[model samples]
Target: MTSIVGYARVSTRDQNPAAQEAELRAAGAHRVFIDHGESSRVVDRPQWLACMDYLRGGDTLVIRGLDRIAGSEVMAIEIVAELGRRGIDLRSLTEPAFDTTTPMGRALFSINAVSAQLRVDTIRETTRRGLDYARSQGRIGGRPTVMTPDRVEAAERMRAENHSYAHIARVLGVGASSVRRALGAASSR
Candidate 1:
């Protein structure tokens, strides 16, 4: 007995997944699972995981679109490949030609997979180049320090005078954590 499991997702709470669910039901879905306020980038969605668990060999998993199942084309390809390996077919209502059971569909999916891989590779290369350039220019990217040198010196003086962290913080008009961080930074240097 083959089952058709439909999965619908919306990235935000304001977005409604009713239309996708309706389409999936109209397309002959045996069961439909909806996940609202869930990003496709997250693989641990409860409804999505339930749909995956409900699928068996020769079952079909339906989605409104590739983006409904995955945030990126790479993730989409990986998910579709995993379904194929599990002997489950993946069908996109919006992309009728993306069926993995057909040769032309497989070719189209392969093209998308190759494009996604190329895009990921390009992004990795660009990030490496940008980081290398920043390193050569002696520029490090991170959050700026909240405490200034003058505040640090004052905190150190207070600490040397037997003032507790909370006391130093009260004198410096900052949080105790800030005083501790200042002391730690001074010690590290």
Candidate 2:
């Protein structure tokens, strides 16, 4: 037997899922899952994972809107396709056209998937250009190293004393990678 499973989500803790829950219940959902303070860009959502684990083949997954499942159309289409492959259905209460049970819904999602891929490609290209410009200006990205000059000196002295990289890192309150790099750089000079 197929069961209706509803899900609600809020991007931040300050938002509430009460209204979505009410609507899902009204739509005949027997169980509702919610995720709070979770980003849609992140796939490792706790509540969503739980909802997936509980869902069985032939069950319908319900949501207030498509965006509740995925922020990007590509991801949205992929998720729906995955569900379809599992013999599951997807429905959105707000968008009547968002019903995957209908041919129209399936067509729309296919088009949206292409647009989503384009969007992802555009973002990657723009980011690449921006990074290139930043590099040309001598502005580097990424977090600065934790190893200071004093730490480097200490690391060198410790290495000369035959201390292990892990031991040096523990005494300096840094990582073994940092110790190894510092020692390697000092020796190279």
Per-model TM-score, in order, reads 0.78, 0.72
lDDT of 2 by residue, 1-189 (tens): 889999999999999899999999898899999999998877879999999888899898889998898977777877888898888889999888788878898787677777778898999999999999999999989889899999999998998899999999999999999999877888899
Candidate 2 lowest-lDDT run of ten = 106-115
lDDT of each: 0.88, 0.89
Sequence-dependent TM-score of model 2: 0.72
**Count of residue pairs whose backbone atoms collide, per candidate:** 0, 0
Candidate 2 off by > 4 Å: 12-15, 125-154, 162-177, 184-189
Please provide, for model 1 over 1-189, each residue's C-alpha lDDT reduced to its tens digit, 9 standing for 90 to 100.
988889999888999888998999998897999998998899999998988888999998888898888988778878988998999988888897777767788788888788889999999999999999998999987767667899999889989999999998888888999889879979999
Clashing residue pairs in candidate 1, if any? none
Best by TM-score: 1
